[model samples]
Target chain A: MIANILDGIVLGLQFGLLAAGLTLVYGLGGVLNLAYGQMAVISAIVITLALSAGVPVLLAVALGLFVGGLAGLILDLTILRPVYRLRGEPRVLLSLLLTLGVSFIIDGFLNWRYPLETLSLRIPGEAVEILGVPMRRGSLIASAITLVTFAALFGFFRYTSLGRAVRSVIQDQEGARLVGIYPHRMLRLILVLSGVLAGLVAVTRSMVTPVDAQSGLSITVFALIVTVVGGLGNVAGALLAGIILGIVSVIAANLIGTYISLIILLAAAALTILIRPAGLLGVKE
Target chain B: MLKVKSLSAGYQGNDVVHQVDFEVGSGEAVMIIGSNGAGKTTLFRAMCGLLVPSSGQVFFEGTDISGAPAERIARLGLRFVAAERHLFPQMTVHENLLLGANPYRPDPKTMSLILDLFPRLAERRRQHAGTMSGGEQQMLAVGRALMSKPRLLVLDEPSTGLAPLLAQAAYEALGALRKQGLTVLVAEQQVPLAMSFSERGYVLENGYIKLQGTAQELAANPIVRRAYLGVT
Candidate 1:
């Protein structure tokens, strides 16, 4: 039971990273990029392909991460910007469709490239024993990576000028503009940051489980659930919600079956919607 | 210093402010007074570049700023405090004030001055801005704008919803800022209060400037008194 719980937490922390990206985009751009998961999957694929081409693992991972940032920038410039000029329900519906369409295109290309194969990272380390628990060395490393990344993110928002500008834009676009902070420029930075985060999640998760081309959709769905359960645009909520969801899923799977986990997730999301539409930590606008 | 030449602007496809013209010299206080929906806010929006004018130009310090983006205008040392009081509610008062000074390296003296100007805000400096009362939030909005030490400060309905005492207090604060040589362009619906502070005033009606004069002259004009000052 402890091992199952630990596994769930490991998965949850990685999901937290992905959900944070999604929430940031939605908060700033009001766009739920369905292509978000594809961005991660593409990073994984790039690393795998580089390794196959005789590239070292570290260099391949670096290249994959770089692509992630580039993909985010491209998406922002091409797809999200024009849609953001719109208002009301039209803006919401249109951006949703546009991102979904992009998701399909990415998924199709990835499927063509990899077919039915899956990719996994092989770290050269032995499992470690801690307090009577035998832990996979890779999981321990992934947790460490998540912790460092989260800390860095916190520091960026709290201390850096660019990060503060992003926060101001998220709070009120016109207000930010009045203070000489351009929302569009901030939006670009956010998308790039989002890409970087998704890339990190890709590399970390691919270490533990095999990631296939079709994995993008499931990843996107899980992240979306976590974001919703946490609160739409709340970063801390996403992190907390991710862990809770992770624990609940594992417990549900243990008590019933793997299929019951989905039911549990859906229920949590439904309860949140009915009781707290703004989300647990979402600021009521 | 600011100048507006035949400025016309509005929302969507409709023009709410048409061919309005005005000017304000450096360190001068000018008021644009109008009834609700008489284009005061709309004109302010165009001047700040939140709305592009359909026709006309705005020059700030002789630079043609018409159609320039709001951020660009703000960078040029003109700050607009919208009447909505768009404070980052989740953030503390100190953080909000810090963001106001974000364009330039923040000065501790300016923060101290703003805190002095709004003692209520200083008392709640550590509190989240959104939790404050409306009057307190309004003060914070104006105080935040002052954080940048703007060359020109534009206020939209600064005391629109406040109690009479709060409104008086807000104007007194502005009066103190004016004494410090802050060039101000204020849009107001409260005719008497506005005229009391401004050296010059313009009366806007249906998107056009119906009258313009020295504050005392406009205040004493029988027509102005009957129409806007609630007197026979």
Candidate 2:
């Protein structure tokens, strides 16, 4: 049970990071990026290709992360241009449809080109013992990276002026404008940041299990579940919900079975909605 | 410092403020007085670039700023504080104030001035803006706008939700800022408070400027007294 919980923590940290990216974009600009998972898959594929071309591991990962951010920037400069012209429900609907289309196109292209490509970052080390349970070095390293990323993210949002401007847009677009912060510029920046986060999740997840061309849908689904269970646009809520759901999924899989654990996770998310519709830490609208 | 020429604006295709011509010279305290739904808000919104004007031009410091986006206008040093005070509710008072100087570092001297102007804001610097009382929120709203050291501070119904005493107190703060030589253009429904604070005034009725004169002139005008001042 201790080992399972530890493993769940490892997974939960990734889940939290994934949801943070999705939530920020939705909160900042009402843009629901359905192609988010495809971004991660593309990053993973980029890293795999770079590695096969004999690039150093670190450089390959960096290249992947850059590509991820570039993907977001491209999205903003292209399809999201029309989406920004809209307001309220129409904006959300149009963004969803457009990003869904983008996702399908990306998924199809990846399947056709790299059908067997996968990313598996092997951290060569013996299993480390923690609390009398043996943990894989890759898992430990991945969790460390995730924790550090979260800390940096929190610090950026809390301490930096640029980060505050981003938060201001999320809180109130008009208020942000009154302060001379352009909503569109902030949205573009966040989309890029979200892409980098997606890439980071793909990299970390690959350290635990291989991430392949077909992993995009599952990634997006997991992110959506964590995002909803956390709150649509609340970062801290995402972290909390991610960990709780992570543990529930692991424990359920241990006690019942792996296939049923996904359903169990969905049930937990549903229960959270029924009980606190605003999410665990979401502000009541 | 600001000029509007034949400005007409409204929601959709309907013009709520029609042919509204007004100007505020440097260091002047100007007021646009009107009752609720009399197009005061619409006029201010159009001038500040929050709404696109159907036909007209707005000149700030002799440069045309008509139909510009709100953020661009703000960066040009004309900040608008809406009646609803669109503050970041989840953020602390300090964060909200800091954002008012966004894209630029918060100047220490200006920060000190604002805090001194509103001691209550200093006291609640760490408190979330949404949790503050209506009066304190009003102070924060004005203080936040002041952080940018704007050339012209355009305010819309600053006294909207405040108690009678608090409303007067808000004008008192604005009065103090005016004494500091800051240019101000305010829209107020509370005619007496505004009349006392502003040197020049314009009366907006329906969608047009009905009267423009000195405060004393408007205060003594029989029509103004009968319609707004509640004096027999």
lDDT of 1 by residue, A1-285 (tens): 887788778777877877988888888877788888998888888888888899998899899889988999999889877787896678778888998999999999989978765668756677888666788878888878887888888788878777778888888888999999988888788888888788888888877778878888888888888888888767888888888888888889888999999989889888988888877777777
Error of 1 at B57 (Å): 1.5
What would the TM-scores of all predictions be? 0.96, 0.99
Candidate 1: stretches off by over 4 Å: A124-126
Give the lDDT of residue A19 in candidate 1: 92
lDDT of 2 by residue, A1-285 (tens): 898899888888888988989988998899999999999999999999999999999999999999999999999999999999999999999999999999999999999999999999999989999999999999889889988988898999999998999999988888998889999998999999999999998999999999999999989888888988998878888899889888888888889999998898788788888998878898875
How would the docking of model 1 be graded? high
Evaluated on CA atoms against the true complex, candidate 2 attains a DockQ of 0.92
* Residue pairs clashing, model 1: none
Which candidate's TM-score is highest? Answer: 2
**DockQ, each predicted model:** 0.83, 0.92
Provide backbone clash counts, one per model.
0, 0
How does residue B220 of candidate 2 score in lDDT? 94
Model 2: per-residue Cα lDDT over B126-209, one tens digit each:
999999999999999999999989999999999988999999989999999999999999999899999999999999999989
